[model samples]
Every structure is written in C-alpha cells, then in structure tokens.
Target: MIALSLIPLYLVAVTLPLILAAIFGGPPRPFHQELASGLGILAFAIVLAEFVLSGRFKSVANRIGMDVTMRFHQLMARTALLFALVHPFLYQGSPSGGQRPWDPSRQLTLTTDLSALATGIAAYLLLPSLVLLSIYRTQLDYKYETWRLMHGISALLIALFLLHHTIYAGRYGAETPLTWLWVAMTAIAVGSLIYVYLIVPMKDKRQRWQVSAINRLSPRQWEVIVSPRGHSGLNYKAGQFVWLNIGHSPYSLHENPFSISSAPSSGPNVSFVIKELGDFTRSLHQVQPGTRAYLDGPYGSLTIEDRCEPGIVLVAGGVGIAPLLGIVREIRLTGDPRKVRLIYGNRTEEQILYADELADEDVTHVLTEPPQDWQGETGLIDAILLDLILPPVQVQDWLFVLCGPSAMMDTVEDYLIARGTPSGRILSERFEYD
Candidate 1:
C-alpha cells in the first residue's frame, strides 16, 4: 500500500506547479511560451523529487525495494534532463527584453536580465554533464567516493540554480503562492541530503557495532560478522541488507551495502557474505577483528517470513546467496514448516557457501565447471535445469525469491513467468541495475 501511494503522490508533486500557475497566472501566453514554462516547471519538480528517490530513504526503499527505487531515480533523472533540454528552445522566437510598462505580467517578452538568464544557462550545462557522468561513472578513473561527492555537490548546485531561475524568470513563478511552493519543495530536497549525510550518522554514533570475525569463505569471497556493542542489535527481517562502514567514522562515505547472511533468530551478530568486487570489498582480507563499524540500514524487501506461500524457492548465483542463506537459516532456526528449496549456482564447487548447513535442505547445486568426480547437477541455472528441478505443481504455487547477477536473474524471471507463475509470487532484488 505504501508503494502504491508513491505514484499519485509523485504525479501531484510534479503537476502541482502547473495547477497553481493556471489559477494564479494573470494571462495565458502563446502556446510555445506555455509549453516552455510547463516543461521547465516539471523538470525542476522532478529534479527536486530525485533527492528523495536516492534509495537511501527507508520509508520508500524498504517497501518498494531498493533496486526499484534506484531504477526509478535513474529513469526520472534522464526524463527531467530531456525536459530541461527542450524547455528553452520553445521560447526561441519570442521577443527578448525586460518587462514592458504595458505588459507588467511579462506575457509578451522573455526576460533578458543577465542574472536570471545566467542561472538558467548555468543549470542548462551542468545538468547534462551530471547525468552523463553518472551514466558512465564506472568507465571513469575516479574513485567511487570521489564520484559520489561530486554527484551530490553537482545536484545541489543544479537544484539551487533551477530554484533561482524558476522564481525570477518563469512566467508563473513570480506569483506569491507558486514561489513559496518552490521554496518549500527545494528546502525539503536539500534537507534530504542533510538528513542522509549528517543526521543519520549522528544517530548511528550511539548504536555502534564491531567486527566480531572475518573468515575466508572461498578464494574470492569472505564472511564478515559484526556484533552490536552498546545496543541489543538490529531489528531487521531475515534476507534484508545494511550499509556497513568498517574502520571508518560514522559520518564517513566509505560504506557499502551488503545482504545479511545471519538470521534474526540466530543471534544479534549479523553476517555478510561479501565477494571482492570494489575497492572497499577488495580490502576485506586486511580488516581486523574488533574494528569499530556502523550500519545505516536494514533496507531492501527481499524477505519471505511474512508470506503465506506454502513453499519457497530460493534462487542464487555465486555470492548472491547471501540473503538467501539468511532466509534458509531463519526457517531452520524457527522450525518453519513451509517447504523450502534453494537452487544455488556457481562456476565451481569450491565457490559454494555453507555447504554443510545447507546439506539437509532440498538444495540443487549447479556448477558451470564441475570436477571430474562431481555428482551434483552441471551447467547454468537455465530453462532445462529449472524444468528438471522444479515440478509443475511447485512452480504454480511456490514463492520464488531471486538475487543474482542481472543476466541470471533476468533469465530466471523470464522463464518463471513463461511457466505461468504469477508476477506477485516472484520477488527479486538487484544491487546493480545497469
């Protein structure tokens, strides 16, 4: 229900400016000028809303899933950029000058004031650069933190610039009510950043955690366990994730999101199965036990504890088994009667995690490169493998949870839907949407 409410809320926010303009606007300008103003208003509104859609807000992300929130953020940013790009072009043929004496409402002339035009021009150039850099961030040589800082600063600047441009140069923005609306919305947008960077960290300083243990699970994977120090522990459902900051200050940007591999029923200590991928992850081997850490979440909706489905199907690829492991442990620890099956896929047998723990469960392990004496199933978890492992009855009624590389998840989801599985029954979470 919370997720469904976001759509109408978003529509109202983006269209509110247009509605107010129509009510308070003194006169209707030419179609081109109105088009220019409407697009400009919408673009600014969307950019402001992007601040809340950064996937950091638990109220939004926790219910809808972080992956979906981030995808929406990306798509809307591009759309706003397109709207901003086309906004000025529609007013090209209009006469450019200061407000005329007879037309105090400025309906017949475009503002030629240098300061107002400068803000709009500056935003015009910076918005595109910001979007392009984000789209190709991985291709660049900068560190992730550096890129992140630059992105935030750039966005804030764009918001400020757009706010100034809208209030001073917009045909409808000079009205008192519309101006106040923009100010309030901009304040909320900027406050979201302050909340994320400063307020959240200040709160985390009290509820600290420490690395209790770190163990190499495989050649490329490691298990990190953190125990709460001053508090009881996190109150997260099994299969959720948290942003972990290790050996860094609570306010530091050196945090990374990882799924919890430990079940809530087990203990307060939370475990993460991390594979060496980014710079922070590559240094996991060197992290010492008892190092101070802070967690900023219990985010993501990749959980199954509340579901009424009679059976559960867990599909994992490589280290994507982290959250699924938590779910399996929860079921075993709590003695849940619902039947559970885990279809775990990896390149080799050695890459599999918690083999002994999962030995008793109905798990089908798939290996792309199995050893000569291997007895388990071989090849990727594609249509043929799924058909062999999952019977028709199970496919129709069971809840399917997936977390994996994008390609694997897409293949599994597409195949599952083709087999008549309802979309609502299949839940998935992705860390990398691109």
Candidate 2:
C-alpha cells in the first residue's frame, strides 16, 4: 500500500511545475511554444527528483524495494531525456529575437542570445550521452567505480545546465515564484548528492568494521566475513543486502552491494557469498584480515520474516544463495515452525555452495551439468522441474522467494503466476534491470 501510494505522489510532483506555469505564466503564446516550455519545465523537475531516487534514500528505496526504485529512476531518466531533447526543436517556428521590453512575458520573441541558449544546447548534447553511457555501461570496458563517479558528476552537470537554461532562456521560468521553486529544487538535488557522498560516509566512519575472514567457497566464489568494530552491528533481517567497502575509506566509491549470508541470529558478524565476476570480487584474495571496512546498508526487501505463509520456498541461482543462506540460518537458529524449502541451481557440482549446510533441509539441487554418479536432480530449474518439485497446493499458498539469473527468475515467476499463484505471494529482487 505504501509503495503504491508513492506513484500518485510522484505524478503530482512531476506535474506541479506544469500546473504552476499554466496559472502564473503571463500570457498564452502559440500552443507549440507553451508545450515547449511545459516540456522543459517538466524535464527539469524530473531531473531534480532523479537525484533523490538514485537508490540511496532508505525512506523511499526501502519501501518500494531498491530494484523497483532504480527501475523507476532509469525509466524517468529516459523520459526526461526525451522531453529535454525535443524542447528546443519545438520553438523553431516562433519569432526568434531577444526578449522585447514591451513583451515582459517574452511570449512572442524567443531568446536568441547565445549565452541563454548555450546551456540548453550543452545539456541537449550531454543528456543523451549520459543516458546512452548508462544504458551501455556493462557493454563498455570502463571500470564500474569509474563509471559510477562519471555518472554522478555528469548528472549534476546536466541538472545545473538545465537550471541555467530554464532560468535565463525560459519565459515562464523567469517568474518569481517558479524561479524560486527551481532554485529550491536544484538546491535539494545538490544537497542529496552531498548527503550520499559526504554526510552518510561521515556517519559511517564512526560505525566502523573490519574484515575478519575470507575463504574460498568454490573455484570461482568466495566467502567474506566482517565484524563490527564497536557497535552492535547491523540490525538487518535475513535476506537483506549491504553496500560493503573493505580496505577502503568510508567515503570511497569502492563499495559494492552484496547479500548477507550470515543470519542475524548467528552473531554481530556478517558474511557474503560473492562470485568472482567483477574487478572487486576477483581481487578478494588480496584483501587481508583486520582491514578497515564500512557497510552502508542492510538494504533490499527479499526477506521472509514477518510472514504467515504455511510454507516458504527459497529459489536461488549461483551466488544468489547468499541471502537465502542467511534466511535458512535464521529459520534454523530461531526454530521457526513454518516449513521451508530451498531450490538451489548451479551449472556444475563444483559451483555448488554450502552443500553440507543445506543437506539437512528440503533442498532441491538442480545442475545443468551433473558429474558421474550424481544423485540429485539434473538440468536447469525450468517450468517442468518446478512443477514436478512443487505441489499445486504449495504453489498456490506457499510464499515464493526467488533471487538469481534474470532468465531463471522470469521463468519461475511466470510459471507460478500461470499456476494461480497470487502476485503478492511471490517475492523477488533483480540486481540488473538493464
């Protein structure tokens, strides 16, 4: 209910500038001119709001789920980019000249001054570049950290460019009330960045942590454990994740999101099962014990704690088992009476993690490539396999939690829905939306 309510609120916020412009705007110009200004105003409003929706605000992201928040953010960026790109083109037929003194509203004469249009032109070029770079970030060869830093700086630059363009070049934007609103919105946007990059880090610096252990779980996966320095540690639920920064300053952008593999019931220490995929994970062996660390989360909503479902179904693929492991441990440690089942899939036996720990549970191990003399289920966790493993009653009633490869998750979610499972009965999160 809370998440759904945010949609209407967001609609009102983005459309507020347009509404104000219609009321306070001096005189009606050509329909195209008014539309051009409206688009520009709406685009700037969205750009400002993007800073807060950058998947850093706990108040917002926690309620809607980080993946949903980020997906919305990405969608809005593309929408704003479309509106901004088309803004200047709509003024082509308008009278091109400096704002006339007689026409204080500037409804007739469009600003021809290069200084006023330059920022808009710059933002026009840079906004598409920013959006394109983000869309193709993984395809490019740049480091993730470098790309992230560039993204932030470029967004701020675009926001500033749009702000200047709107104030000086726009007719409705020069109005006192709208101008003040734009200034306040821009300030809030910039302040959000400062809070994320500076204020949050400063606070985290006090609640420090240290690396305690790093062990190889499989050929290409590792288990990293960190212990709190002085605090009682994170008050996170099972199946939550954290932005972990090991051996780096709290303010550094070297942090990466990883799911917690250690249960809250276990101790004040946390563990993550990370696959050697990215630059940071591949270099984990170089990290030493007792290295300074920082955690910026406990984010994500993939937990199964406060549910009244008769049974819980945990589906994980590859390193996606991290949070599920935390959940399993919690259920065991707390002796939860609700029945639980884990459907863990991997490509090979060597890729499996914590087989011994999961041996006691009702786990269905599916592998694409099974070794000789294998006894567990084989092949991918497809619709057929899911139907065979999960009874119809369980499918309709049990709480289904899934995390893994996008294809596998889509498959499971679609199949469950086809089997009459309510959407609310399923829980899932995607790290990659692109």
TM-score of 2: 0.98
Model 2, 163-219: lDDT tens digits are: 898889998888888888888889999999999999989989999999999999888
Top candidate, metric lDDT: 1
User: What does the lDDT come to for candidate 2?
Assistant: 0.90
Query: Best-fitting candidate, measured by TM-score?
Result: 2
Q: After superposition, how far is residue 143 of candidate 1 from its true place, in Å?
A: 2.0
Residue pairs in candidate 2 whose N, alpha carbon or C atoms collide under 3 angstroms = none
- Model 2 stretches astray by more than 4 angstroms: none
Query: How does model 1 score by TM-score?
Result: 0.97
Worst 10 residues of 2 by lDDT: 425-434
